[model samples]
Target chain A: MIYLRLFWEFFKTGLFAVGGGMATLPFLYDISDRTGWFTHSQLADMVAVSESTPGPIGVNMATYVGFLTGGQAGGMAAGVLGAAVATIGLVTPSIIVILMISAFLQRFRDNRYVNGAFYGLRPASTGMILAAGVLVVKAAFLPDGLSAFDWRLPVLAAVLLALTNLVKPTKKLHPIVFIFASAAVGILLELSQ
Target chain B: MKELLSLFSTFAKVGVMTFGGGYAMLPILQREVVENKGWATEEELADYFAIGQCTPGVIAVNTATFIGRKQSGIAGGIAATLGIVFPSLVIISLLAGVITQFSELTWVKNAFAGIRVCVCVLIFNAVWKLGQKSVVDRWTAGIFAIVAAGAILTKISPVAFVLFAAVCGIVLQTLLKKGGVGQ
Candidate 1:
């Protein structure tokens, strides 16, 4: 049942998550709320892991979530199977749709309605991703709504934001570098305390 | 048979090199599929990227399937699609197995906490860049505001929002055309 549900969830994600990898975040959050398979914090970990890893971030996330859920349900073997199921579920729609599009590439490309839909979709996708980013910030910095705000994480996030965006030397650096650096800082901070 | 293997291997290599996300894969994809393999021309790749953006699913996977199908057939598309995701499946499965086992450690927990904050910031940057590119005019800005507010306030499915926006785009464009207001 878990496997079936996993496939179904990712299938919907793949089928409707237009834009790119980040577009899938809202759906993953919704899945977390519905299934309780993972927490928002765990979803954050998945995002970090997915971002730093090779291959597409969305595919990495789907595999990561599926593996974790399956490992919890059964064992390591089930975990691998779950990863496959979820990843396949995620890509199944792309494969089908792309193939269909391939058959009529010229027609699809020239369609006025298609262009119009994308014009609307682009901004809407951006909006959804923006909403997802806000949700992530809340989950990371204010887990218990506004009442229980954590200053330390927000401060860390601010420094990181400055380093990545404001600092010229670091602005062009790969995200993996920032992620590893943050992890090291986290460990060091914890050790000192 | 040879072509299928080549499709798989080429995409597997692209998959391994693609860091961050779909957009980051563009240069690598251009180099491998266009410059090296000649599977697609530069303009064709751009077209694929544009189409991939609107279609459902990850843009990188969609591009791979597009190029692959153009080369051989549906089988080629399947091969490339599987190749692109194979690395992620293997790598994440291993990482997930290990992380789940050690997630109880205090140090591991702290590291994840920091990583999570960083991830949040990264997503914020992505949203900012995307907004700059997509929210060009008044109508788009309106759509962006409405969707963001709806997503934050309601528990409705994100899929509904996407579908609704698509319909709105078509209708709005058609109305504008009829009114002689060229976009």
Candidate 2:
């Protein structure tokens, strides 16, 4: 039953969580609210882990959620199976869609209706991504766990943001470098406090 | 068979090395599929990404499928898609046992706090670049503003937003066609 439920939920996620990985967040938030499979704080942690890890964040999240839910029912084997099922469920729609597109893309590529719809979708996706970015900014700065806003956090974010942009944009540093440096800063801040 | 195996291995490598999800994988994808393997041309890869973004599901999976199908057939697509996700399954499953407790630790929490901030910056960069590309004309700008506001301020389902945008585009394009206006 859990496997069936996991597959069903993630199939829907795969079908509709359009635009990319972050677009899936709203659905995952709703899942948390409705199913109680994971808490919002856990969702935040999932985001952090999914972003840090290799692979699509959406896939990582679905697998994590499945593993947790399955582990609650059984043990490690169930957890691993749940992870596999959930990942497959999440990618199923992509496989289907891609196959359909490839089949008809030659004939449909110049279709005006297709073009028009995508014309709209392009900006809409951009908006969704922007909203996603804003949400992350809000979470990063105004975390539910933190009762008080430390002004220094925002200053730190701004300094890092500027550094990412201004520090020789031509020969840009890898994002991993920034991630590690920021993590070190975070640990240092915690230590200082 | 050999080509399919290589396709699988190449994408598996990409899945392991690339972080930050689909957008971050773009360069690697271009490198492996377009430049290295000659499976797709640069323009073809760009087209794949465009369609991938608009279509349902993960961009990485969709792109892999596109290239895979181009290379062989349905089997190739399946191979590539599986390859892309194989690393995630193995990695996430391995991490699942300890991640919960590990995340709760103070230093881990601190580290996450920092990582989240960096993620925000990365998202901002993605949005800025996407906005420049997508929000070009007046209608698209309007669509962007409304969708952005709706997503942020309301509980409207994202699926609904996407459907509404598609409908709006059709209507707008139809009206423009009737009025003899160019998009």
Candidate 3:
């Protein structure tokens, strides 16, 4: 039953959450709210881990959620099965749709109508991604709505640091370096407090 | 048979190298599929990316499917898709076991908190980079604003917005084409 539910829920997410991995955040949040399979904080943790590790964020999240939910029922085997199911469910739509596109796109590849459609789609997907970014900020910084200790300062600093990598010597470093650096800073700050 | 194996291995390599998402994976994809393998030209890969973004799925997987199908066939598509997702499945399953068991620990908890904050920045950075590529003109800017606002304000499904935007693109571009705007 858990495996079935896992497949169904993630299938629904895959079917709808258009754009990319970040676009799936809203649906994942909804799943957390509805199923109680995970918490908002856990969702945040998933994003962190997914971003730090290799592979697509959406796929990583599906596997993580599946393992967490399924680990509760049986054991490691169940958890692995759950992950496979959820991950497959999440990508099933992608596989089907891309296959369809590949089949038909050859004839229409140069058609202006098709080009026009993509022109419209590009900005729209960008908007959706931006909306996803906003949601991530809200989930990470204000999970309980507004509070006394505003976390925006560190967020801004983090943005600057990430952006700084675009300019000079730091630009060549791998993103994992940034991820681990932040983790170290977090532990240091928490222990100091 | 051997070609299919190579397709699978190539995508598996791409999957393992991808961090963040599809955008971050572009350079490596170009290196593997374009420069090294000659499976696709640089231009064709860009086209695939554009098509991949509009479709309903992770762009990374979509692009892999595109390249795989181009190289072999539907079987190749499945092979590539499976290859791309396989790494994620293995890594996340392993991490989930460890994370679930130790998430309550003080140090792990704090590290997650910090990671969450950094995630906000990373996502925002994606938006900035994607917007630069996507929002080219006034019309696109308008589309970006309207779709963003509509998504936040309404209960409409994200699919509806994408469909609407597609329609808008067809209409607006057709009109612009007729009017000789970018011709």
Candidate 4:
């Protein structure tokens, strides 16, 4: 039953979570809230592990969830199915549309409305992407079980934002550098206390 | 072939180094695949990105498959896929041990916190820039707003959202076609 539930949940997550793996946060959170499949902390750990690992963070997480719920096979099942569902979910519709339109692509290829529609899609996708970031931020910093949301992280986030935009010099800085530098600074601060 | 091996290796390097997710992988992928190997042109890479966006897997994986298929045919596609997945497996395995062991380390914990926040910022920036290309008119802007609202209100599955976007594009295009504006 657990395995079936895992498969279904992941299948659903894969079916809908778009923009990328992080976009699945709300679904994962919902799953956690509804089922005791894993704790909120586990979800966070999954994010860390997923981010630190490879392939896709969301896929990595599905595998992690499967593994935690069942074991090796469970993990593999969840991972593969989650990936499959998500991939299929993401692709299936587009594939149908492309196939349907392939014959007429040339006819409407230069159509303004077609072009305009794509133009619209870009920002809409961007919005989804932005929403994904916010949801993840909420999950990452505050989490569900928190006694209180961490004020420092938000303040830190604002600092990072100002530093990125206003500082100008830091705007083009490699993300990894910011990642490591911030980490180092965070550690140093932790150690100082 | 050795060429296939090289393709595998380069994408593997990309797969290994990328920490966050799709957006994080973009710069490195562009640097290595587009800039370094010259295997794919910028336009081709952009096309791959669109296809990747429409595909059913990680954009990086879908991209590898597309590029590999383009470069070396079926075998090339397999090689590229292998290359991309390799780093992820190794990195995750190595990290599993290190993270498990160091899970409680203050420095490690803090560092993760720091990286997580940075990932958020990077995601925002990427979306912001990408939005510049996407929201070109009121109609598109309306699409953007509608999709954004749906995403926030429901946190709908990405698949549904993408599908919704695709339908919206198709319908708009069809209507425009009916109006004979393109002629």
Candidate 5:
């Protein structure tokens, strides 16, 4: 039963987490809320581990979740199962449509109604992305919950946001720079206190 | 065994180093797979990227598996994927149990806060860049907008948005092609 649950949970996550790895953030957040599989802090840790790991952040996180819930087998089950199901789910629909409509792909590309729908979707996805950011901010910065918001949290956010812009044109700069910089500031603040 | 190990390490390097995943791995993947080692050619990499995108489980993972499979079949896929996942498993296993305790540490908390903020920026920048790639023309722009909005607005699943977008994109592309859109 637990195995089945894990399969379903990740299958659901993979099937729906369209925008690839980062897109999984929203679904994983949902799972965290739905099942007490992990806490918000744990989710942040998952992000850290996922980010620092070798595979896709989404898969790594999924494997971690599976391992936490059911152990190694569970982890592999979740990773492979979810990935397989999700990938199939993602590909099957499009492939079928494409193959069936192979003759008409070009004309179908220009429909005005389709255009309008997509135009609306962009801002929507952007909003989802922003919402995920806000959630992360709350989880990472205000571990004590949002109502007890601290100036330090938002200030830290602003500083990083500003610093992120600095890495400009040099986007390839290692993620460690931000991590180390943030760690340094954090360490300084602690010592000062 | 050595070939499998290389597959694992190469992807591990990609997983650890990259701030943004998926599309972000493209250049690094090319560098490692194509340039550093003669693992795969530029064309093969491109094919892998296309297949990876169309498939699932983080572009990085999919590509790793594809290349792995290409090099050594099923064993290679498992090996490459294992390489990708090993780090996350170890790191999360260590921290997940006691993360809240660490957050209670002032400096630790602050550092995380800053990292979260940085991650937010990274996520945004990556999305924006991808959005540019995804929105090629008026039709594609529409599909992207529709998918983004659908993802944001309704409680529709994210998978739905992608599938729907692809369907719409393909359909639009098909229709337009009939109408000489592709040309």
Candidate 6:
């Protein structure tokens, strides 16, 4: 049942999550909320892991969530199987859609209706991604309540934002480097405290 | 057999080297699939990328599937997909197994705390970039505003939002065409 549920959940994610890896965030957040299979905190970790590692972030997250859920359901063996199932579930839609597109590539590409739909989807997907970002911000900075607000974390986030954006030299640096550097900063902050 | 093997290996290399996200895979995919393997031309790869964007699921997987299917057949599509995700499955499973075990530790928790904030920033950055590209006109800006607000305010499924948006898009386009206004 767990494996079946895993497949079903990820199948929905794979099928409906148009756009790219980041676009899957809302679905993943929904999955976390609905299933309790993973926490928001854990979702952030998965994002970190997915982003820093090779491969598509969406696929990485599906595998990570599946592995964790399956491990809890059975053991490491189930975990591996769950990872495969979830990953396949994630990509199954792409395979099916691509196969269909390949058969009628010209017509599909030239269809004005398809283009218009995409034109609409582009902004809508961006909105969803923005909403997902807001959710992450809430989860990370306001998990408990506003009363327990931590200023240092926000400062760290701002610094990272600036480093990745406004800063000249650091702007072009890969995100993995920032993630690793943040990890070290986190550990050091903990040590200081 | 040889064709499928090459398809798998080529995509496997793509899978392993792709860092960040699907967009990050573009250059590597260009090199492997176009320049080296000659599976797809530059324009063909661009088409795949465009289609992959609007299609469901991961763009990288979609592109790989397209290239694979083009090369061999449906079997090649499966091979390429499997190859692309194979690295993710193995690598994520291993990391998840190890991370779950260590997540309880203080250092790990703190590290996650910092990483979580960093992730928020990254997601925000992505939104900024996506918004720049997608929210080009008044209609799209309207869609973005409404969807953003609705998504945050309501617990409605994201799937519903996407479907509704697609329908709205088609309808709006029809209306514009009837009105003789250009998109």
Top of the candidates by TM-score: 2
For candidate 1, write residues B1-183 as lDDT tens digits: 899989999998888866556655655665578768999865465446556766899988999999989899999999999989988888887778555445556776566666667767776775665566677789989988998899888967666887888888899888877889653
Question: Model 6's A-chain: what TM-score?
Answer: 0.58
lDDT of 2: 0.77
Candidate 2 local lDDT, A1-193, one digit each (tens): 8899889888989999887787788988888898898899888989878865778888889889988888788999999898888888998998999998898875686888866776777778778667766766776788764666777677777887788777676226655566678778888887213
Going through the candidates in order, what fraction of the true interface contacts does each contain?
A: 0.73, 0.67, 0.69, 0.37, 0.25, 0.75
Model 4 C-alpha lDDT per residue in residues B1-183, reported as the tens digit of each score = 998998889878777656667656655665577667888754444434554555444566666766776677667766776676665544443454354455566666666666667667666665665666666667767877887788788845555666677668778767766789756
The TM-score-based order of candidates, best leading, equals 2, 3, 4, 6, 1, 5
Candidate 1 off by > 4 Å = A1-90, A101-106, A144-148, A191-193, B1-80, B92-99, B179-183
Tens-place lDDT per residue, model 5, B88-133, is 5555455545634554666655555455555555555545544554
Relative to the true structure, candidate 2 has a C-alpha RMSD (angstroms) of: 5.3
lDDT of candidate 5 over A57-133, digit per residue (tens):
67656766665665434544454443343333332332332233322423554776544434334433433444444
Clashing residue pairs in candidate 4 are A14-A86, A16-B157, A16-B158, A16-B159, A17-B157, A17-B158, A18-B158, A87-B56
Q: Which predicted model would earn the best DockQ?
A: 3
State which docking tier applies to candidate 2.
acceptable
- Model 1 deviation from native, Cα RMSD in Å: 7.0
Native-to-model Cα distance after best TM-score fit, residue A64 in candidate 3, in Å: 6.0
TM-score computed on alpha carbons, candidate 5: 0.56
Pairs in clash, predicted candidate 6: none
True contacts kept of 3: 0.69
lDDT of each: 0.79, 0.77, 0.76, 0.62, 0.55, 0.79
The full ranking of all candidates by lDDT, starting with the best, is 6, 1, 2, 3, 4, 5
Q: For model 5, what is the error of residue A66's alpha carbon versus the real structure, in angstroms, after optimal superposition? A: 7.3
Model 4: per-residue Cα lDDT over A88-152, one tens digit each: 33333323333334324346868776564554456566666576667757655765346766667
Shift of residue A183 alpha carbon in model 5, Å? 2.9
TM-score list, all predictions: 0.64, 0.72, 0.70, 0.65, 0.56, 0.64
Model 3, A1-193: lDDT tens per residue? 8888999999889888776888899999999999999899998988767756779998889989988888888899988998999988998888899889888877687898888877887787767656655665665566555654555436644554555446677655544455556567668776212
Standalone chain B TM-score for every prediction: 0.58, 0.65, 0.64, 0.73, 0.66, 0.57
How high is the DockQ of candidate 2?
0.47
